[model samples]
Target: MFTIPSPTIVNTSSRPLSETTIVRRKTRPVRVGHVTIGGGHPVVVQSMINEDTLDVEGSVAAIIRLHKIGCEIVRVTVPSLAHAKALSEIKQKLVETYLAVPLAADVHHNGMKIALEVAKYVEKVRINPGLYVFEKPKPNRTEYTHAEFDDIGEKIRETLEPLVVSLRDQGKAMRIGVNHGSLAERMLFTYGDTPEGMVESALEFIRICESLDFRNLVISLKASRVPVMLTAYRLMVQRMNELGMDYPLHLGVTEAGDGEYGRIKSTAGIGTLLADGIGDTIRVSLTEAPEKEIPVCYSILQALGLRKTMVEYVACPSCGRTLFNLEEVLHKVREATKHLTGLDIAVMGCIVNGPGEMADADYGYVGKQPGYISLYRGKEEIKKVPESQGVEELINLIKADDRWVDP
Candidate 1:
């Protein structure tokens, strides 16, 4: 027999409510190989390969692993001409094996030559606007005069013209990625080390790309600080709307160190922009390996109802009213159901917040008395079982409902 706690049932739905829906910003799509950014496409998840670009075999192995785990785009550094040339071989090997994963080259310093060389090999070239045109800020110089700034812009155009032409002709894309720590001196003098500075830094290159009639561009405004990252992206969106430029945005929080701290920082920055519908592609930067970053990306996207990959687990913090070994039971429950994708499973320690807390979850396991557990398929109690029997019963319930998927 089923035991229903008074007021246990709460409103639960499989889909998010209408009022909380995120309306993605409208922008023209930019194609990076086979993946599409903006234009109402799902936000793409991408990661950079830290392996040496010269290690074609190592890089290919890493890419294959990342591809299996659902990384849509992959980027590698092309700091030298050799690395740039290596990209062609990498692409060739990937094609020979039918990987077809879109590759991007992150170029700086000697970007123009590397970009030009890698343009035909990779789908996109990412250049940091701050480092592309100007040398690192020297201690002697404070700011650039108006004419000096114009000359700098002109020089940038001169350097970029050939590569821009090559990329345009080759049907390639560019990412003017601007970072908080690397703003050019002129921008710093004008706007200080703020979001305005980062936006201006990127806008300068964006205007350059536009003048050359190259529209296949994506932009990023990244900072290690979550607040700064969020502010920069918000400011960039407003500026893009003002300029009537709907270029796709790449979102990330740079140097977000590893483990829980990294995940929290990345989520706060990238997740906020995603929630506001302001990002086209996202990378969850962690100190860990690149392949480890993919699941976190999917997790953030899934929580926002933007994308789905694995099961969503909701477990309440244990409290005085708890009636079971929640940690052990929860682990057991997850181990059994981790492969279930797109389902919300709630493991509540006690009735206090069980039903209400699990209102958004599709299935719920709530602790009742010392050894008892109540199972719910969306609020209504389906059965009562002992603590020892709960996990198996949950699986049985799922199978009975025909919601079981082989792991």
Candidate 2:
């Protein structure tokens, strides 16, 4: 890949069959277990295990759950030697069993031990500058002078940098998952509480690691706030460009809450960056089981038009024109087809809007009589399916056509 891209001249056919102006950032590949992360991997979706590490079976069980939901990479917290010891067994179970998803070990504070124990078995290790600190503000902390915060920040990097050098020496795939909330206070003080400040803090670590000749690197900058997360990444990308760095970017919104709100917030942050072609991998952090992360991550990727597979569900918001109990039918269809595994299906209220709405679906349904729907496979009606059986019939038709997914 070239450091600077050649200028684009669009061939004139009147419409775009290819993205003419999109310049993909040059990146080297970084593999995590069976899956690839950076350097043009297909924007993989990942999640982490939230189970107790001591229970190896339970931890593997959590990984299995994430795998079933289409998670490509799953991370586990290895805070102690016990958790570190379990990684080899956990990896053995994953490769031998069905969930061959790659494993990442989250190592904080105790960097040298984490490196010593997990460097061999795990595919990736997460290093955070903030993890070295106790994360406390002492009494009258709000009134602390600038120097105290600066010292706190400096002390953290001093605790963490040796591990970056050690991991580099050990030749391990390392991901620097930077925390926006715990950014070095000195950087924050110098650059203010802005996205530039966040990027400056992260780039510091990247520079340190790069100085050690560690080329196998992935970077993430996560914030609980959506705008902060977005702008920080934009600024980081800009900075990386200026420095000629092409590390794979990990897209995420940390601590996003649960269910609809969480999904939306994650979409708003991670989704925006992805849509702009800036993300290479994604993790949607919710304070829930890792299983929930997989589906949401897949959905976001699907929405971005990056991954194609079994089914795509498109439903209309109920309106005056809607008939045949649209909302009820939509819920049933969505629930039934959730496991389609790259399946594309759309459910709509009436042909008054459904056909135009679902022009892209592999199989779709629009309102007919009170108990029927207009069944469609790419503009041609195969039959009028009974509304009660619409969900099952559509899924079966997809299965028959694709011959790829397990029904």
For this target, which candidate reaches the highest TM-score against the unseen true structure? 1
> What C-alpha lDDT does candidate 2 achieve relative to the native structure?
0.74
Q: What is the C-alpha RMSD of each candidate to the true structure, in Å?
A: 9.5, 6.8
Error in Å for residue 233 of model 2: 0.6
The lDDT values for all models are 0.87, 0.74
Residues 1-407 of candidate 2 have per-residue lDDT tens digits of: 01222222222122234763333455678877667776767888888888877788998888888877678878889888878888888888877876566777888873656655877677788877555455553444334466776676566556656666665665567888878887654544456566666677677767767766777788898999998898778777877776888888889999999988998999999887776667789999988777778778877877767776446778888787777787788778877776566656777887787778788777788886678877888777777878878877777776667743554
lDDT of 1 by residue, 182-218 (tens): 9877777777788888888888888878888999999
Candidate 1 Cα lDDT to native: 0.87
Count of clashes in candidate 2: 10
Total clashing residue pairs per candidate? 0, 10
How well does candidate 1 score on lDDT at residue 72?
Answer: 93
Task: Spell out the clash pairs found in candidate 2.
Answer: 309-342, 310-342, 310-343, 310-344, 311-342, 311-343, 311-344, 312-343, 312-344, 312-345
